[model samples]
Target: MRLNESTIVSASPKLIWDYIADPGNALHYMSGVTRWEVVSERRSGLGARYRMLIQVGSAEVGGLIEVVEFSPERDMAWSSVTGVDQRGRWRLRGVGGSRTRVEFRFAYGVAGAGITGYISELVAAPSLRRHLRRSLQLLKRQVEHERLRRDAAARQATPEATTA
Candidate 1:
């Protein structure tokens, strides 16, 4: 199964990239995810590994995932090797003049284990889709909120520095 979502953020690509590419920010943006912690020497670039947990219907599942691709302010991709069979990618596109469009894609194979995985994916697809959509919405909100805070701080500073 695969899922995709795109959201516009009122900030520069560089600023958004800094947060999205950080390993510590996964749970901050992912709605289904409950925990994410870096497990490799590399932090957020290629080959970095992280242990993550996703709340799937009352059960949490996930494990060590390695970053396969990382391009500063552009793209980030990861694949799981030791746990669930899944791959995910995040693409950042500049919308020109201080705006960014972030596109997220997730692809995962359902294990044919006793028909449960199949059944679960069937029943859970809608919920998972909703989670993904809300996750992107939350990400947009967080980024835009940060942008507003920065702008407010700048506006306040402008007045003080100009007077001095």
Candidate 2:
């Protein structure tokens, strides 16, 4: 099954890309993801691999996934290397000042499970869509909050120039 969702975040594309492209920040925004750990020495960007598991029904499903495409602050795509057959991509575009349009796409299917896999996909489609939407919402909240925090810190760091 294929699922796509998008949201606008009040943060620059670079900020959104930096946060989403880094697997270390997945737990902060990815809903239903129970495990997201780097399995390869290379941490972020192209060729990076991670062992991930997402809650599905009463079980967790996933495997090692490798980054198949990386376009700096624009796009990041990955596919499963082992375990469940899946592909995912994140696309970010700057929309006006300090606004980013972020889209997440995911596709998954069983390789040899045949009918059972189809049935599972049918059953899990709704939940998966819901999770994807929730994840985006969480991501938007996180990025905006971080932006606010950073802006506040910058303001605090800059002392007012006293008039002579």
lDDT of 1 by residue, 63-108 (tens): 7799999998999999997887788888999988898999989876
Best by TM-score: 2
* Model 2 Cα lDDT, one tens digit per residue, 41-100: 899888999999999898899999999999998999999999989999999999898899
Question: In model 1, how large is the Cα lDDT of residue 113?
Answer: 62
lDDT for model 2 comes to 0.92
lDDT of 2 at 136: 97
The runs of at least 3 residues in candidate 2 whose Cα sits more than 4 Å from the true structure, single-residue gaps closed, are 161-164
- Candidate 1 has which clashing residue pairs, if any? none
| TM-scores, each model vs. reference | 0.88, 0.94
How large is the C-alpha RMSD of every model relative to the true structure?
A: 2.4, 2.1
Each model's C-alpha lDDT? 0.83, 0.92
